[model samples]
Target: MRIRLLGGLEVTSPDDRQVRFTTRKTSLLFAALVLAGRRGHRRDQLSELFWPGRADGQARNSLRQALVDIRRSFPPGEHATTYIDGDQDSVALIVDPDQTDISIFDLKLQSDRPSDLAIAADLYRGEMLAGEALADGMDEWFGPHQNKYEQKAQQLVERLSLALSQPGSPEETACEGLAERLLASDPTAEAAHRALMRIHTLRGHENAALRQFELCKALLKRHLGAEPEAQTTALAASLQAGKAGDLPLTAPKANAATGPKPPAPSVSTPLHDRPSVAVLPFQNLSGDPEQEYFADGIVEDITIALAQFRHLYVIARNSSFTYKGKAVDIKQVGRELGVRYVVEGSVRRTGDRLRIAGQLIDASTGAHLWADRFDGTLADVFDLQDQVAASIVGAITPKVEEAEIERAKRKPTESLDAYDYYLRGLAAFDRTITNRSSLEEALRLFMQAIERDPEFAVAYARAARCYATRKSNGWMIDRAQETGEATRLARRAVELGWDDAIALSYGGYVLGYVSGDLDASAACIERALVLNPHLAAAVGVSSWIKICSGEPEAAIEHASLAMRLSPFDPRLFAWQFNVGLAHFCAGRYDEAAAWAGKSMRHQPNYPSAMRVAAAGLAKAGRIAEAREMVARLCAFDPTLRISNLAEILPPFRRPDDRDRYIEALRIGGLPD
Candidate 1:
């Protein structure tokens, strides 16, 4: 019999008749034995692994029955018994190791010969046990095996792509197929994408190669919100310049006779904690020499506005303006300025009409991230300049952050520095779900960031927010310790980052919520707003502070402004929740419930949204729906009680506001 277990379990008799097990467990057990080869599993171990907590006798009997089922799977009189032999203590599948596809795959991989490696590359149909439904504990058992095989497949594809670099050789064709397969399985496989680009270029299909680069860029952006790596970008640039013929496909790999080869040369790129951007002086499209000053003024204003954001590194006006009135390469400008992003534009005037157009491009890949134009009359030139500057700053800040977050996500965890870890923590914390585990992970990463750089103010600020998240979700254990930690982190953040608007905003919010220090929180957030009024997060937190301070109108207005500032921000749900809370405080129960529903749609498990929806619904006389929301709330926080509201919730500045919220929740059917 021939059995294959690489992709999924498959059994074929000597006569080529297909054989399948009726029970999934039996098939899994059989596959396990096949992987085990001659030295099989002990019966007791197999029994407990598959049928946990069962009586010893019952588990042993089940194992025996499974073995019998495996034996009967083959054709009658084929003596399948010889293939499966074991003493009472252990079960073993005795078959020629070569008969199994996995063994042949391993054997071929060991051979330094290119042909054997090619065969090994073709043998990986997919991840081990592909499409096979694994039982709960079984996945834990199989996970290591799956990871090992997946890594092996990745190695094989990369090795083949490097070893077989000839233009039209059979080995090259096989490498192309393998790279394609790897990409199909993992769209974020940059190595595979690079391999395909090299392959297409070697085949004299330059356009196809360029298209492959575009595909890779889109895939990275769509899935990871990141740009291509520097080396990949360089390859694409070389291809565009028609110099790909001189490019080596890869660093050498182990040859049939030679040993392992040297590593590829590293590409040089600047390392910055925050993404850097340069706003080049806009070209004066108008024929009038007076229009040159207009373009320059607008670019200068934009550079200043962008510099206000703490997370961005905006190039100085003098440096950027040196390229004024000259045609410049975006990539060269980026390299010279040590920036990841470049903003270029043109200003045109036709009689009294003014039109200014701008585009944001990734400096490394030359990919345009955003583009837009504004039209107005030059009647109020300064007003138009301010409007356009604000518009550009607002539009590109979020885009830059998105790209940076994606790049951080793609960085190897083993090599991460403080800033990379902080970015990763930010991404995890921004998840709409707001789950406990994700919050925990965000906290862990932020603490790691702090460990790498003790004075990382923003990291401390975000780490405090993670505790606030846990408290909001009712995931906090050992309340005093967590509360103390959160307060310390917040205080340290504010102390260290007095000039950083983002740090102050995040830290202030955490302090206000956890420590109930409304005055200090308000002062910090107000300072942050003054520092960077266009910052959506600062604005959002300011709105929450307003809600706590009993200024419902100001709260709603700030929340609205925050939303308008970054319409696509991941924290939109929080702003929506803030609006709901302000309306609830203003006693608009129905409207509050509606807004809470909207927030829940964006972030389904947001604890504040759930509470607001339940209380507002009950106040609006929607008892049935209110009870349903309460049921979900209780499921999410099983320990929640009306009596301990102050422990879990932030204190309202007005005592009546707190009492009103408590009364509403009590009426909503929350358990005492």
Candidate 2:
């Protein structure tokens, strides 16, 4: 038996091989059998699936005739059995699983085993039986399946090409052969052409690469009547110019090769001249090793408190803590960390009389910006932390203006108790991912903070964010209810704390994810950024908004800024995922894969990051890898599917961007 699914659904048998059933009802029966796999459809189910409008007796009679035609068209022992019919029971395809090209193609595409690509390539016969006609009823049943298989074939071609192009690969021959076969199937496939060009270039045949370009142009003109995209044109030109070897692979640049060289630390410019700064772990000069935690806590407090200032960019605690015990050069550290200013300090506890020494250095010039010492009793520890934050903010305020500084100082609610609760909630929220119970505890803490002060916008915002996470991760039993509460809390946060960066950022993110209001989310995130440039969360969320809004370049810029601002962020996975998503939307699949890989490295179990990575790999034509990642992602979040992705995904204003994601997932073989 032969099954064709590239264009329309069909089944053929031996002897009378031309016995084709072009009617919609006949085709619908075939599609239903294929989709159901080995499970023979019940007689009632078959009748309903194919002849839903017909009477029960008529539907059953029609199904029986179709089966009889299938068996009669191909005699027994000549071809594999095409149908398995049981009296008063069900019907199914008795053919071997591998006999159906569509099934084989999907299996090979999803397999990560070494020989999968070759298997997938061999199974794709052509463009799914193009130009075939079926009844309206059958068209509805088979159209999507046909398109999906064709897409899967195209994706496999891409994967085969990339896999073959990598240096020192045993599969190089296999990849080249696969690319040739794919091109034969769809002569105008630009991706296949590009892959061939890369292979030729890698083999030292530059002219061969140029010839591939010409072939692409000819095929496009003859078939689709189009030209290669700008990137393709540029690549061809580079090959012609004998500079094809200079093309960079899709990988992150390695760190500096030389040893660490610390430049002089001195203040040449004031702290206000810089957009962002990082305060490394403060040294413990109290002689007792137990004081290390105290010193570290001081740095954490100062970082968090200063991060609240709208004008000054403060590095996150995780990134800053990376330098805890290492004696590093300040200027090199600044350059590597992408910061313009660096703060170093030491804490001394002498019989409860705490003495703290702090120095701010200009990273660009390796000069000291300011140096100060604070001596007070242990009871003044909290005050000392607040004073440090205030001093840093004051030093950085000149970069904006006196009026802006005054306005930033304006408190939305003058309640120190509320502020403390908010801070505690933040501390808990940051650690909420450690365990399921921790998440519940964190939610409770956030609720407590909100209950203490109904006007505490930041607390409400954080609470909403936590709830959103629960819903997104499938931790909540009632996603609709949790999401509803999250939206309400986010709205309240935005309403109550117009000037609070945390409130605006978290509220905007929740609204974007749950409400699908791109414009409102964008406004909130933009406002948050204006309120606090150092707010990494706001910057990261804004980058995603930009991508979804069809502004990939802007999204990349914002995501880069977020990375620079929070180099050691514990949640760096989120930032990396944002960058990858932007790149994927822009059709830069290689870069997207690289960034997504980084995100996965940072947090292996992050579902959102995994989804982005899978999409990136699929777009880049790494089919086997993409399939593997998709399987992992599906296993991690079983609720994911092509039909529901749009609803679950953050809003993308452009239809094309949304389609790109959906198409990528389809090609990646997302499970139904």
- Global lDDT of each model? 0.80, 0.68
Residue 111 of model 1 has an lDDT of 62
What would the per-residue lDDT of candidate 2 be over residues 1-672, giving only the tens digit for each residue? 567565445566654355566465565566567676665667765676677789979998988887765556544465445555455665666667765777776667655454677677765656664555554566665555555565555556555654554554645565566667668777866657876787787787888889989989877666644456333565686677777655323211222532233333354333342257788888775656776777787777667656765435677777776555544556566766667777777776667777776767656544444555667787777776665544544343332222222222353445435544455455555553524576777778778778877887877888888876775665677767887898899999999878888689989988888777778888999898787666667788888888888999999998887766555455567879888889988999878878887776555556777777778889889999899988888887787788767656767788888788888888888965
Mark the 10 consecutive residues where model 2 has the least summed lDDT. 250-259
Off by over 4 Å in 1: 1-273, 284-294, 347-356, 373-384
Off by over 4 Å in 2: 1-424, 432-435
Task: Please list all clashing residue pairs in model 1, or write none if there are none.
Answer: none
Best by lDDT: 1
Q: Which has the greatest TM-score?
A: 1
- Alpha-carbon deviation at 395 in model 2, angstroms: 14
Tens digit of lDDT per residue, candidate 1, span 1-672?
Answer: 677777777788766788878789988888788877787877777897888899979999999888888777642345543367778767788877767888898888666566887788777777788878988898877875776676566556655655655677776776677777778888967667877887787788989989999999888777645556444666787788788765454322234433322222255447465799999878775656788889989998888888988778888887776665443446666777788999998787767888898878877755566677789998988898987887787778888877888898888878899989888888888864467778888999999999999999999999998888878888788889999999999999999999898899999999999978988899999999888877788999999998999988899999998887777678889999999989989999998898997787667767889999998998999999899999989988888889877776656888777888888899999989
- TM-score of every candidate: 0.60, 0.41
Write down the lDDT that model 2 would get: 0.68
